[model samples]
Target: MKRRDALKNIGAAIGYSAVIPTAFNLLQSCTSEKEKWTPLFFSVDEAIVIKNLVDLILPKTDKTPGALDVNVPQFIDLYAYNVYVEEKLEEYRLSIDSILKALPIPETGAIDLKYEDYDNLLKKYLKASKEEKQQYISDKNITYEALINLRNQSVWAYKTSKTIGKDVLAYDPIPAVQKGCISVEEATGGKAWSL
Candidate 1:
C-alpha cells in the first residue's frame, strides 16, 4: 500500500476514537438523572430570581424542553463559579443585586408571581434596542448589560446542553464533508448545528 493510503486510514481511526467517547458522554447528561440540584453560587433569594429569569427566557413547549428542564441555571452557576475572576464575580453579583432591588420578591419567595412578569422584565432589559441598552450604560445602570450577558450565557448553556444539542438541534459528532449545494433549511430541517 502507498503511504497516502496508510495516512488516510490513520486519520480516520483517530477521528473515530475521539468522537465515540464524547458522543457517549453527551448522551448521558445531568437531565437524565434524578438528582436534587442546588445553586452553586447565588444566594437563596438570588437563586430564586435567577431561576425565574432563566425559565422566562426559555419556557417549555409541547414538544421541546425549556432552559430549566435542561439545567441551564446549574450550568450558569457552575460556569460562573469555575470561570469568573473575583472582580467579575463581584461585578455580576452587584448587577444582579441592582435587578433584585427593582423586583418585589416576597420574603417567602417569588413562587406566587406569574411567569409573564419575569418575561416582561427580560424584554425590558435584555431584549431592548441597542440605543436603550446604551442609555442604560450611560446612566451608570449596568442592569441592561448584565441582563444581556446573563441571557446570552444562559442561551449558550441551553443550546449546549445534551438534550437540546442532540434532540432539539442537529448533533453531528464527527462532521463529514460540507454540502454547500443544499440550503440550510434543507440540510438539517432548518435546525442549527451543534458543535
Candidate 2:
C-alpha cells in the first residue's frame, strides 16, 4: 500500500478501537443491574433504619411513589458518605443510634417499629419550637443537627430522583423564555419544579 493509504488505514483502526470501548462501556452501564447500591458509610442495620425513616417521611400516596420506591435511602447514604466530615459522620452515627435505642429492637437485631412510630417522631421534631428542639437535644445528648441533616438529605434526594423529579414534579426539560414576573402557582400549577 502507498504510505498515505497506510496512514489513513492506521488512523481508522485507532478511531474504531477508541470508539468501540467507549460505546461498550456506555452499553454496559445502561444494561448492568449489578450496579446495585451498597451503602458506603452506613452499616446494614443503620441503612435499614435510614430506609424505614425515609419511607415514613415520604410514604407513597395515590399521587406519587415514596422515598423507598425512589431509592432515597441509598441516595442519602451516598450523599452522607461523600459530603460529611469525620465529626459530622460521628454525630450522625450517634444520632441514628439514639433514635434506634428509643425504639424497640427485635431478636433479629432490626428495629421493631412501624412507619407510624417514625412518623410520630418526625412530627414531634418538626412541630417543636426552636427552644424545645434545643432542649430536647440537650436532654438527649443527641443533636437535632443530625436529624435535620438526614431530613434535608432525604428531601434533596427525593426531589432530585428521576422518579420524583421527572415523573412526579413539574419537569421542563426544554424551558421556554424566562418569565421574570410570573406567579409560582401559575408557572408550575403549585407543583414543585424539578431543579
Candidate 3:
C-alpha cells in the first residue's frame, strides 16, 4: 500500500474506534432503565411511599401521562435529597414518619406503604366524610403529628405535579415557540385575532 494511503487508513481507523464507543455509550445510556436517569435520594422504604404518593397525585390517564410515567417520584426524591437542606430533609422525615404511624397498621415498623394503602389513608383523612374528620378532630383531636404529615405529603405532591408541568412538558415562554409565527393581535373586544 502507498505510505500516504496507509497513514490515511490509520487515521480513519483511529477516528472510527473513538466514535464507536461514544456512540454506543450514548445509545446504551438512552435505553438504560428509568433508574439510570433518576438519582434516588430516598431510602428504599421512603421511595416506596413516595412512589405511591406521586402515583396517587397524578394517576395515569388516557389523555395525559401520569407521575410515574414522568418519574415524578424520582424527581421528588432527588429534590428532597439533593436540593433540600438538612433542616428541610429532617422536617420531611418527621412528617413522613407521622403519616406512616397514622395509617392502620399492625406494627409501626418502617414498612413501605403500597399505593392502595397510601390512597386509602389519604382519602380517609382528606376526602371521606368531612363531618367524621371534624368530629375526630373535635373529639379525639388530630395530633400535631397527623397534621404535619398531611401538610408535608400534600406539599410534596403539589410541588411534584407543578415541576412535571413546567420541566418535563414542552412548555415555553411567549415568543419561544417559533420564529415568525403569526402574532395574535388583540381585537377591540379583547379577543385574539391573527395579524
Candidate 4:
C-alpha cells in the first residue's frame, strides 16, 4: 500500500475506535439501569418512565407522600397486568411507545432520567387549558391521552395507598361523631377523607 493510503487507513481506524466505545457505553448504561427493575406489565424502560412521571405528578412535599413513596408505579404495573384485557393492554403498550418516541433521550443518556427531564414534558401536556385538552382528545393525540390516563391512575394509586389513607388523609377507625355535619375544611383540617 502507498504511504499516504496507509496513513489514511490508520486515521480512519483511530476515528472509529474513538466513536464506537462512546456509543457502546451509552447503550450499555441505559440497558443496565433499565434491567435493574422488572415490571409486571411494562418493559424496563416503560417502568422507569412511569416511575419518574408519576412522581412528578405527585411529587414529595413536606406534608404529603409522593407517588414513588407510595409505590404507585408498582401498583400501576400490577393493576394493568392483572386487570386490562388483551386488546386494552395492546392499546396501552402502543400509546406508551408513542409517548416514548416523542421524548428526547435523557441528558444523562440513560433510561433513568433526572426528574426535570420528565417534568418539562409533563407540564407541557398536563397543564394545558381545558380547551387544549379537549382539542387533544379530538385530535386523538396518543401522548396527551396516555399522560392524562397515567396521571389519573397515579392519583388514584397515591390516595388509595395504606400509608396515605391511614396516615396522611383523615381516617377515623371508629366514628363517634359525624363528619357530614361539618364541611370538609372543618372535618379533616381541609384534607379529604380517606377512601
Overall lDDT per candidate, in order of appearance? 0.71, 0.66, 0.51, 0.71
- Candidate 4 off by > 4 Å: 1-37, 106-114
Candidate structures ordered by TM-score, highest first: 1, 4, 2, 3
Q: What's the TM-score of every candidate structure?
A: 0.75, 0.68, 0.51, 0.74
Task: Name the TM-score of candidate 2.
Answer: 0.68
lDDT of 2 by residue, 1-195 (tens): 764344344435675343333322222222113236577778877777787878777789998988777777765665455444567568778878876765566767655656676676677676678898878778764535556767776786677666677888989999977988888899988888886
Candidate 3 — number of clashing residue pairs? 0
Kindly give the number of clashing pairs for every candidate.
0, 0, 0, 0
Model 2 per-residue lDDT at 111: 51
lDDT of 3 by residue, 129-192 (tens): 8687767667654434354354454444433353443544433444333445343332122232
Residue-by-residue lDDT tens digits, candidate 4, 55-100: 7789999988787776778777765664455676799999888777
Task: Give per-residue lDDT, candidate 3, residue 15.
Answer: 55
Candidate 2 differs from the real structure by a C-alpha RMSD in angstroms, to one decimal, of 12.3
Error of 1 at 177 (Å): 3.0
How many steric clashes does model 4 contain?
A: 0
- The collision pairs in model 2 are none
- Kindly list the per-residue Cα lDDT of model 1 for residues 1-195, writing each as its tens digit: 754344344435675344333333332433434246566777767777788898887889998998888877766765555445577679988888877776766666665656776777888887779898789888877777667777887787787677887899987888887888898888898999975
